[model samples]
Target chain A: MRRYYVDYFLIFLGSFLIVYIVLPIAVILVLQIFDFSMLLKALQDERVLKALKNTLITSTATMLISLIFGVPLGYVLARKDFRGKSIIQGIVDVPIVIPHSVVGIMLLITFSSAIVDNYIGIIMAMLFVSASFTINSARDGFLAIDENLEHVARTLGASKLRTFFTISLPLALPSILSGAIMTFARAMSEVGSILIVAYYPKTAQILVMEYFENYGLRASRPIAVLLILISLTIFITMRWIVGRRRYA
Target chain B: MLKLKNVSKDWKEFKIENIELEVKKNEYFVILGPSGAGKTLLLETIAGIHIPDSGRIYMDGIDVTELPPERREIAYIPQNYALFPHMSVYDNIAYGLKIRKAGNIDETVRRLAEVLGIVHLLNRKPKTLSGGEQQRVAIARALAVQPKILLLDEPFSNLDVQIRSKLMEEIKRWRREFEFTAVHVTHNFEEAFCLADRIGIMLNGRIVQVGKPDNVFLKPKNEDIARFLGYENIFEGHADGSRVRIGGITLSSNVTTFGRIKVAIRPEDVIISKSDGEFEAKVESIESFGFASKVTLSINGLKLKALTTTSKIIEEKIREGDRVYVSLRGFNLL
Candidate 1:
């Protein structure tokens, strides 16, 4: 009888969480459907299209850069124990803990002359706040693999590099793919850092903010709805892909 | 053939020291030790997974201490079998041939698979195979490489009794067919007894005794080794010439010693009689073990264990608190 109440309480809490997270997106999606012409207009507008394209390109570049550098760092962190490893992990999470605007300012001061107000600046801002997700996810993935697999490969006459590429990389692909998805999604939605560093080539988030400031809520609501729909579609599709590949 | 001379490794918590071993070609040398006795560590050191801090390893009369695992023609199967989960059975068996670019890879894999009885499972993933099937695949994979030496770490520890025995017989047959030298590590006395050409008893990181199975089992050098080899009744006795006295009983022995000494007697070797014969003892406890019953006898504040057949126990109607006679006819001095 006591367990029954506890189970009911848990169900209530879970339902509350689901509704709290989903209501806003549901409301936005339904609002855009009511004003279908505005959504179509936003989709066709050149400025909106350009901002969306810029967001996509910079987010993709950020994901690529994270893959290039973060995966190897994650492997080392997962497999080896050395001095200052905990400290290095804490440093990797610094961008996540610090304010995004602070990260923007730090980037502006450090690489102002080279990348400020350029396309690279947007990618840099996105990468700064999002690369940690990729690193952590990859590390967790590598941690799940049995160390004996690599040892067995070596005993079967595989060189270290060959074992890493042929065995470790394939076994860890699902986690790496999920991390890439998160990197892309985080990069796509980043705004506060780009606001301080590179506002000229506007991303979708910055464009939404600009419209809301220059205009009223009524004028900017449609754009928000559009961005929400696009992000939701891509995120869900990517998650589905990752889910399918996980068990394969 | 493989040899280790003064091989030693130092972990923070445990250490194996000054290990010396030599395995002849096509001989299965088993190192038997209890858990946490650095058995796996010693095996890994020989496989080149770990570099010994202070010794050399030789294979086929050539020093290969500094060589990496890939450079040495050694195949190691870990305790869990460690099959490549992402690959099919065929690919798992063919992995070494693919890496070495050996000719007729499919022919070799198929032949080995047929011998291992895993020919129909070639297309299935390792996760889909049963434990016995997966082990057969691991064996096929290791043998596919045609390694100079095969190393198995507790290969039969995870199987049921029936399967364990079956796998043991299978491994022996595989070795005969492929003609490979092997170094097997285990803690089970039955496994060591059934599989070893020569047995090495490891205690506290050292090989305390090494010889044929019968010699090592019957003549343990010290109390510790004797205890591990299933000598249940070990007592300190005063030795003078060939006679030893223990707790108001004098026993004759072939051992010629003249001071304090320890005597070890197997529980089965102590003769039990209902009528008066030798030292009298009270039955403290009797535990059944299928074919035999372990009878614990108490005599003059000393506890001793003896093994008697269940039929004998039933015929004598031996129960707790009953008095019996015990004779130390076959025992060894350590």
Candidate 2:
């Protein structure tokens, strides 16, 4: 009887947070269902389409850049132990903890105006705030693999590079893919950093804010609903892909 | 042939120190040690996985201490087999050949798989295979490369008793067919006895004794080796000629030693009889082990263990707290 009470209490406490999270998204989607024609109109608007395109392109570029650099860093952090390794790991996690606006300001100061206020600057901002996800997930992925497999491959006449390509990299792909998806999602939702770095090539998130402030909630609701739908669709699809590949 | 002049490695908790060893061509050398004795470390050091701190390794009389494992042409199969989980059994067996870009890759893989009895498992992933099947795949994968020396670290330790014995017998046949030198490590006495051409008894990260199986089993080098070899009756005794005196009792031994020394008597050599024997002893305990029972006898403050068949115990009606006659057939001076 005591155990039953404890379980009920714990579940009640958890359900409050779950409702708190699901309520806002549920209300927005339900409200948009009544305004479905407005959503169709926003999807056809050139300005809205351009902002969505910019968001997709820049976020994708960010994801690719992060994959190119972050995966190797993750593998190194996972496999090697050297001086200042903890410091390196700490550095990888710094971007995640830093405020997104601070990330934009840091990127603005690091590069010249020629680089900022452009597509590159927007990508730089997104990558700064989101690369940590890829790095950490890839690190965890590599750590989950057995080192004995690499050792056996070496003894089987495979060079270290060959072993990495054939054994370690393939096994860690699912984790890496999930990390990339997280990076894409994080980049897409980024508005604070882009507002500071490059407001000209407006992302869908920045446009939502602009619409809300300039034209009130009625003008912004459709784009907000559209952004949520697209992000959820991509997120769920990517997760499904990763889940399928994981078991395969 | 592989040789280590003085290999050593130091880790935080364990160390393999100044290991001097050699394996002749096609010699099946087994390193027998208890867990944490650094058997795996020694094997890895020979495979060039971990470079020794301050010693040289020679392969066929050529210094290869600084060489990596890939260049050393050594194959290692760890206790878990370490089969590539992402690949099919066929691809695993063919991995080395593909790396070398050798000709007749399919033929080599098929031949090895056939010999190891894993031909039917060619298309299956390693995760789907049984332990025995996985072991066979690991063996086939390692053997496909035709390495100069095969280093197996407790290969059959994961299998059940029936499969373990079967694999042990098949491994002997595989070694003959493959004609490869091997350095196998295990803590099982039966494995060491059945498979080793020469046995090296490892204790505390050192090769304490190395000899033929019978000699090493019958004659251990020191007190520690004797204790590890299951000599339960060990005592410091004064020896004169072939007789040793231990605590108010003198026992006859085969080895001749002088003055103060340590002697070890295997429990199997301690004979217990009801009618006639050298000394009378009180049966302290009788523990049954299904087919055999270990009988502990106490005579004049000294304890000795004797192993006898369960049928004999039943026939003679030996039980705890009974008076029995005990005699030592032989003893080893340590």
Candidate 3:
């Protein structure tokens, strides 16, 4: 009887969690559909489109920068054995744990406040915070490959760099793509750091915050709803593509 | 066509020291060793993945020790058949050619896949294939570019026993058919016997011996080499001519041993008889193998194993704690 009671409690707890977790997203998606006219107006607005374009451009730049710089670092982290590796890894992961506002301050200190006020500041901040995702995922992807494959390619008359591009990169494509998606998405949603560093040319998050602060929920709801829909579409499509790839 | 001179490496836990070996052109050289014996390390060193701390590698009489793997023109196949997962089988096989900027990459992949009997798997992804299919594809991918030499590092270790044997035969046939020179590293003796024209026995990162398979098994230069080759029954005795005097009994042997010599007898070379004979031994244990039965006996306080057929066990009713007469077969005396 005690076992049966415990089992019943577990069942209820699981169902409660499932419902509670899913309820807010479900409510938001449904509520937006009823506000179709507002959604349409927001979508048609040039300001929304401009913010959207800015967000995409910044995210792509961040993603490319991460791939360019972080991938080699990740590969070294995964494959090389040396002193201070743990320390280097800890440093790489600092952005994920540090406060976003503090990251903005750190960028201010490093790049100077004037520099932070420029477009480069936003890109740098996004790279500093979100680049870790790409590095970590690429590291994991490179690590999953057999060291012998590289050796085999080398014996088969391929140089180290050639083997890396041909075998290692191709094999780690799925993980790298997932990492790219994650970095892009994280860059899109970042508000606190960008608000501090680059605020003149408004991003979508900045626009939403401005609307909310100036006109309250009625005016901001449409923009907030628009941002959520855009994020949702990109996130969902990227997840589907990742799901379809062969992970091994 | 391949040579390593004074190659030495220390990889934290494993080390290969001052290793020297050579291979002739078109020879299928197999490095046979146990796990962690530095077989893979040597293969990697040859493939230029790990730069040897000290040594020179020569290929076709030219020094290539410092050359990158690509410039060396060797092919390698790793264990687990490391196929590119995102690419289809055809694309995976064509990658090397495409990277080299070779003409008609499609033609090369198709011909190689067809030779390896993996043509039907061209459109499929690596993960969707069976172990045998994946292995074939990996080999085909390496062979497609027509490298100067091929190196295999425990490539079939993950395969099932049945498939391993079948593939072993196929690889042996493939080498002859294509006149491909290969350096194979494996822990399996059966594979070495099946595929290797010459075998190099490696231990602790050094080649202890390299020769024809039969000679290495029969005439080991040292006790260590003998022990590594399954010569389990090593006994200290005095040799007078072709007979070794052990305790108070003497037996004829093929091994040329003098004073203070170690004599090794294979388990299959001992003959066991019931009833009285010149020598007496007590049955210590009995182990039943599928084709034969092994009976353990203590001959004058030394434990020795004797092999007999299953029918002999049934007829003689051999079991634990039975008195038996053990005779030396006088052959395979290491």
Best by TM-score: 2
- Candidate 2, residues B1-334, lDDT tens digits: the string is 7888878898657789888888999999999999999999898888888889888999999999999999999999999999999999999999999999999999999899899998999999999999999999999999999999999999888899999999999999998899999999999999999999999999998988999999999999999999999999898899999888998898777778789998799999999999889999999999999999999999987988998889999999988999999888888887
> How close is every model to the real structure, measured as TM-score?
0.97, 0.98, 0.90
Residues B159-219 of candidate 3: C-alpha lDDT, one tens digit per residue: 8999999999899777766788899999888998888899999877889999999878777
Expressed as tens digits, the lDDT of each residue in B154-208 for candidate 1 is 9988788898899899888987899999889999999899989999999989888
Grade the docking of candidate 1: high
Clashing pairs in 1: none
| DockQ (model 3, Cα) | 0.55
Off by over 4 Å in 1: B275-277
* A1-248: candidate 2 lDDT, tens digit per residue: 89999999999998998999889999999998998898889989999999999999999999999999999999999999899999999999998788888888888888869667799989988999999999999999999999999999999989999999999999999999999999999999998889998998888999999999998997899999989989999999999999998998
Give model 1's TM-score versus the native structure.
0.97
Q: Model 2: DockQ against the native?
A: 0.91
Error of 1 at B131 (Å): 1.3
Candidate 2 residue pairs in backbone clash: none
Candidate 2 chain B least-lDDT 10 residues: B5-14
Error of 2 at B201 (Å): 0.9
Give the Cα-based TM-score of candidate 2 against the true structure.
Answer: 0.98
lDDT of candidate 2 vs native?
0.92
DockQ score for model 1:
0.92
Give the lDDT ranking, best first: 2, 1, 3
True contacts kept of 3: 0.68
